[model samples]
Target chain A: MGNEYKVQVNHLTKKFGNLLVLDDISFHVKENEFLCIVGPTGCGKTTFLNSLSKLYDITAGEILINGMPVDLKKHNVAYIFQEYSNMPWLTIRQNVEFGLRIKHRPEAEIREQTDYFLDMVGLTKFQDYYPDQLSASMLQRAAIARAFAVKPELLLMDEPYGQLDIELRFRLEDELIRLWREVGTTVIFITHNIEEAVYLSNRILVLTNKPTKIKEEIHNDLPRPRNIADPAFVELRRKVTDLIKWW
Target chain B: MNQNKNGTKDNKKYILMSICSVLVFLFIWELVTDVLGIFKSTMLPSPVKVFGTFIDKFTNTKPDGATIQVHTLASLKVALSGYLIGVGIGVPLGIAMAWFRKVDCFVTPLFDLLRPVPGIAWLPVLIVFFGIGLLSKAMVIFLSAFIACVINSYSGIKNTRMVHLWVGQTFGATRSQLLFKVAIPTALPMIFTGLKVALGASWNALIAAELLASTKGLGFMINQARGIYRPDIILVGMIAVGITGAILGYLIELLQKLVMKRGWRQ
Candidate 1:
């Protein structure tokens, strides 16, 4: 059972000075699972994700990728920040190739991966455009392509589409789902939007306010191409929404 | 297309206005000195007299021991040498200081102590060590430019966004790779700004050192004019300095634009 899980977080705890942000949170993500985490505003969701990526040093407990302890040098991880993390100086093609280059992949593999991801995100035509030249949605697409090109074992996204309009958000969400399906990479997406959690994840983890703990983890068996207006989708969204309401 | 046409038209008008303003200023100076005779010729040379002196100084070397071209070249050589040395040393030292904690701890205290002392204040000590030769003068200019380069480069590296660093780390970048590929590229605009400031400072320091100590150079030519009470010669030296400084600054700006064509502005 332990080996079956890709990510096993055991009693993860984090604090800033005297203020406790995350308190004894425990969870496991199956291999290639699409897990979405939703919580109330200021519920330390970002802190939790940051801890998993070792961006924030946890005060206690451990995080494991596979059966071994999580080590950035040993494991492959990719993060998509709320703000666009595309290197402004690199063109779209170069940006997509950045991680592969860092990892010292074979030249042919780097080009093939970069090309595949760029095409997947529909950015092949804009490969020469710098991040500044692209529109907001296009910039996010470039970021996505860059992340996917790395073929990371764990993909952590922190409200990556939080700033986009609803229409663009849905479009990118669909693209994300398609990419996830094809790539089969384990994904842990953190968002404040309940509908987003319902629309994307195989399972949703609802977290509590302040000293955040796992309120519940609801398994989502909703079929592919989920409709927001579907009764099951609405029921699941409402359940997650009810669990996250703090006030 | 219409907006670009309007922009070009406005740009032309501005150039015309700039030329007219310079002419008007020269006219006023000529009125005060020659036509009105409000001031003696020795006190303020007329624009025409200054113009004549500019041409005469190029051909005549009696007043300064060298032609204007030779003096200009000497000044430029000394200034550029000091400027390049300062950039070569200061930029790397600054980046190292920002990137390594041990380097920062070792260098910061000494740097802070010396930072407030003006570059010209080192003149007496430098002259004593190196004597009143080109070396001493170049050292002063080097110190002046070095301070600007060190400060800007350090800040530039220190101010790279944490998010950028995190992204680099996630991709399995080594410490050295992060510094070279992420921090340095991110710091380029500030590095260029430092280069510009250092350039201007180098020029100022060069002129000051030449005026005080050198036997040849633009500063020496101006100082010689002062000794001989040739206001026209002094006016010519001042104009030359102004034009050369503007041209150097413009060249740096052009280089910056050429390198940053891919929207580093973002």
Candidate 2:
């Protein structure tokens, strides 16, 4: 009751034409916590994130942000959708500045914020290049920059790097952890990859098949800047992997 | 962009075919005139005689101030007026229909019924309503252009990417803001296609109307020339129509290209 929780999902439920997707799922995140959600294909990990972002309406239960309700009109929530919605017409710089433009931020402030994020994502040089001209990984990096530029209290990313190759994906994951630490924003990232979840998250939320309920909350007691080669980290990864496989 | 060597070769082949086609057409025309000798010289003048007569008609203006330029301008004015009016009405209606399902449901059946009846088919009714004047001819062109614009605009907006709409909503854009800023910009390219098609159809319909009912347009001049057994004037009128249509089409293409340079052209 000390108001420690930054986001609270209380018994959230969702249905698509009587096929229940999320069944009374509940979770809580401390402020600035990197919470990774892992599940099988069609398992409603995205559905839960979408409900929190108000992209999809919950059938039942409540989602709260900062002790207040998750009202899309009022809350400062940014989403990185799985499908690349990066405006093809806009350059990388312009795409990063999009949220600021929508909020009507001052020109100087928008420019500083956008430039900082572009540099952070290592895409400052490609600022003038359009999305169609960039590779899939570069495009995803731009999307991350855009979401972080707005400086939202909550960042929702749905499979942001699942489309990239293994090497690029690992590099971007490292960049993401760095950015998350620097920004201190509560991130609810949804992914199906077990190794990525184990590598990036402080705590992992595993969801079961459709009518998805929280199967386990595996807190990675492994220290920060986690070493993937460490025996403990590998054990946790295998545990989460089996939980997902048999579920 | 890669060099289209195969396409370039195709283009060269087409150029040769077109030249051969022109020569063959001329040879066939000459044979018909020389060998058959079916029609009198007054009724169907040879292509050689037609060219000479065309030059004479231009070189020697009428005693009155009327010339070929007058007919060309008159037809252009009617086509422009009809085309503009069609664009004005069709574009907004299309947007509304695509955005609002209730409106689409109410309007679609009516449009479908009317669309199948070509602009030329409406000639008898249009002439009865408006008489054999500029207004009737313009009305026919308007009808032809309007349907194309509406369907183009409707499909353009309707086919907007769902992810794009989600992006706008996530950024806190209101419904009206999304429609004007996102949907319209995304739908613009398809709408341009509609406009180009509509423009061509309107031009064709305008000439058809003038030929059927008018007194001063290029089409009417050609019809009159046929009655007077002056094939040269008819050929000249045909050339004038073709040149003018080509010019208008080229200008529209230029405008589209310029707009496309801007990101919003899509």
- C-alpha local distance difference test of each model: 0.91, 0.85
Docking class of 1: medium
Taking the tens digit of each residue's C-alpha lDDT, what string does model 2 give over B52-78?
766666655542234778778888999
Q: How would you class the docking of model 2? A: acceptable
DockQ of every predicted complex = 0.67, 0.48
TM-score of each: 0.96, 0.90
Pairs of colliding residues, candidate 1:
none
How do the residues A201-234 of candidate 2 rate in per-residue lDDT, one tens digit apiece?
Answer: 8899999998899999988768878888999989
After superposing candidate 1, which stretches have Cα over 4 Å from the reference?
A: none
Candidate 1: tens digits of C-alpha lDDT, residues B73-169? 9999999999999999989988988999999999989998998987878988999999888899889889988988999999999988888888888
The top-ranked prediction according to lDDT is 1
Strongest candidate by DockQ: 1
Worst 10 residues of 2 chain B by lDDT: B57-66
